[model samples]
Target: MSNVKNTVIVITGASSGIGAASAIKLASLGGKVVLAARNEEKLKALVAEIRNAGGEASYFVTNVTDKTSLVGLVEFAIKQYGRIDSLVNNAGLMLFSDWKDVVVDDWEKMIDTNIKGYLYAIAAALPQMLEQGHGKILNMSSVAGLHVGGSSGVYSATKFFIRGITESLRKEVGVDSGVQVSMISPGVIDTGWADKVSDAKGREAAKALNEIAITPEQVADAVAYALDQPTNLTINDIVIHPTKQDW
Candidate 1:
């Protein structure tokens, strides 16, 4: 893989899971990482861990659902490091409940956090990328985006929206812009996503599946793969699943 030394990377939801894993991995490779998330303590701890390991890192306590907060995150990166070479839109919500039993508030929360938040992050980063004429946007989608299952309709819809948005943005940016957009769709990642499920049975099922799930670092490696590609190369979509996962 190409060394991204001196590149500035911003990752949302960097307090934990794939976001945190990606930040550490990228920073370890000499990239300057700006971690964004709502959990200030977690973000601080992660920043210290990276810095202690001889990596360049910082933290921005941000709420992805807030447009202004996202803009601030982008601006902070530029002001702190002079440029943003990459953005990892990894903040998301996966609340699962039967369609009939789904609360409207819960549905809205999923839409706002999982879908709108992704869009806001792109909006925050795209302007700078366009001005620079070169950048990479890596969005975290899921296999749920491509398929349907019980109690996952709303969550799946949000991911499907992510895939569609990433594709549309990729085409819109086109060749001259030097702004590449890609989506990573992972199956049964060992994250805390299952904790969001409201249905006990669904939560248990997800936990059971994740028992043999792929590690967050695995997804992080895929993100680095997309980012390390030549400017002319855009990996439109990547779907990664554990060997034991049939779906």
Candidate 2:
């Protein structure tokens, strides 16, 4: 729990953005990373890249929205590394539109990916961590979770769900179960998250905000810091944003 060297960490949403950045960073620190995402090709490529860098890694094609898929991911990680020391629930979708727009499909996608996905991953990983007696659960949330904003009501709600889960789980398992739970809520980051916005207005708004966004690597560095802490220390929550981001 204290060292990253040889620790087996499972990361969902590992295809790109924060997940990919964190995977590369964690692997570089001598952790054995198990990458999972719906994109098998990207996962394979990332695994190859990690190996090329002299780091241990593997991949499992998975959809976090599916409980069975999450279960399979945990099983694959165990098969690859014998045990899991931490899990990074980073798979999420951000679709912004006014409630009046009734972008029901986008709403469902965010709920499934941002909310249900974390629930499924938690259900699958918590038991294994319990059995191991020491583990960490790192969640990726958003600053939106803290405050509602224009055209992002539903997206913000989903992130709020993540915040609630992270906090509740921290209390549920903190120290007593030897499990550490953390939430990293980041502001606008220059990732593909904006591409998921369906409405022109929403996309334009996100684009404008992204003008002062941070990089996924910066968020990955925060993740690395949280995981690098000693066993007795647990970084409960982190809120990171670009210096120019006023809201």
Candidate 3:
């Protein structure tokens, strides 16, 4: 893997789960990581932990769904480190429910965060990356994007959207620009997501699925792999999961 030493990486959703894991891993590798999330306490604590561990780190409270918030995040990172080397569009929501439940609110929440959030982050970071003549953009996705599952149509659809745009951005922009656009689709990660599921039946299924899930750190390994490649070699996509996971 390429060295991320001094590379400025801004990660959304950095308060927990995959986002938090990536920030730690990248920073440990010498990357100057900027953590962005709405939780000030968690973000502050994480920044201190990374600094105490002798790594460069910073925090910015950001709401990914809001374009202005994302713009501010990019500015904060640049002000801290001068330029953005990568942007991890990891801020997302996954609320599962059957179509019959008509959980419009949950579905909208997923769309707003999972879809719009990613796009907004990209919009805020891509320009800086392009201007610098090189950068990496890793979109956190899921296996559900490749295969729809029961009670997760909306969530799955949002991931599908991620896959589609990642590919398009790679072809339309990445081919000519120095930026690398990639996606990492993880399967059944044990990120305490099951505990957050609001749907009754969906929560039960999620907990059962968690029995076979892998850790977010495992997914972070995949992320570091994808981001640490030379701009000449693009790691387009990676699908990571537990070996026991059937689908």
Candidate 4:
């Protein structure tokens, strides 16, 4: 495993869940964490908490859906820390509904936030990482990406796209540019993600699944573990789930 001390790691969707937990864990491991999320209040509070814990940290209010906003996030990290060692593209959406329900708006929202947002994060961070000759991009996928489930077809599609893109990106950048790309696919994690489900049936199913879900901190630990790997050894993909989760 590589040392994270003084490494500048940027995390998006950092207000809660895996992003927030990863920020705290990485900071504790001596990373200079830069938190980004749309919620300014939460970002400030998290930054303060990191600082109080004797870890270097900062934040930028960002909307990952906007390409320019992600650019600004990268800029903030560079301005504060002088280098971008890794970017955790954890901002995503998971609005689920049966295709028969035709939640077109929800589908568009998922496309914009989950797929496009993931692309924008890569677009914004890749240039600097390439120029530096060594960096990591850890993206958040899901077990849904591996297999389609009931009522989550569109959401699963987005994650599947992420999975393909992360794999392609790893091949494109890892050997030549010294940048490593990784994808974390978590199953039934307990987070605010399910709260975004608008369909009644989807929400009910999510509730039942979350009853046996793993905590966000567990996912965060996986993030830290991936980042801790030696530079030459890329942890390409990780699929984690609660032991009791059959799916």
lDDT of 2 by residue, 38-136 (tens): 888999899999999999999999999899999999999988788899999999888778888899998899899998899999999999999989999
lDDT of 1 by residue, 118-156 (tens): 989999999999999989999999999998766788889
- Residue-level lDDT for 237 in candidate 4: 89
Looking at model 1, residue 234 earns an lDDT score of 91
**lDDT over C-alpha atoms for residue 140 of model 2:** 93
Error of 2 at 196 (Å): 2.0
Residue 194, candidate 4: C-alpha displacement in angstroms: 2.6
User: How does candidate 4 score on lDDT?
Assistant: 0.91
Give per-residue CA lDDT, model 4, range 1-247, as digits (tens). Answer: 2478889999999998899999999999999999999999999999999999999999999998999999999998899878899999898888778989999999999899899999998999999999999999999999999989999999999999999999899989997889989989999988966777899999888787889989999999999999988888999889999999887
Q: Of the pair 1 and 3, which is ahead by lDDT?
A: 3
lDDT of each: 0.89, 0.91, 0.91, 0.91
Clashes of 1: 0
Model 4, residue pairs in steric clash: none
Among all windows of 10 consecutive residues in model 3, the one with the lowest summed lDDT is 1-10
Q: For model 2, what is the error of residue 108's alpha carbon versus the real structure, in angstroms, after optimal superposition?
A: 0.5
**TM-score to native of every candidate shown:** 0.96, 0.98, 0.98, 0.98
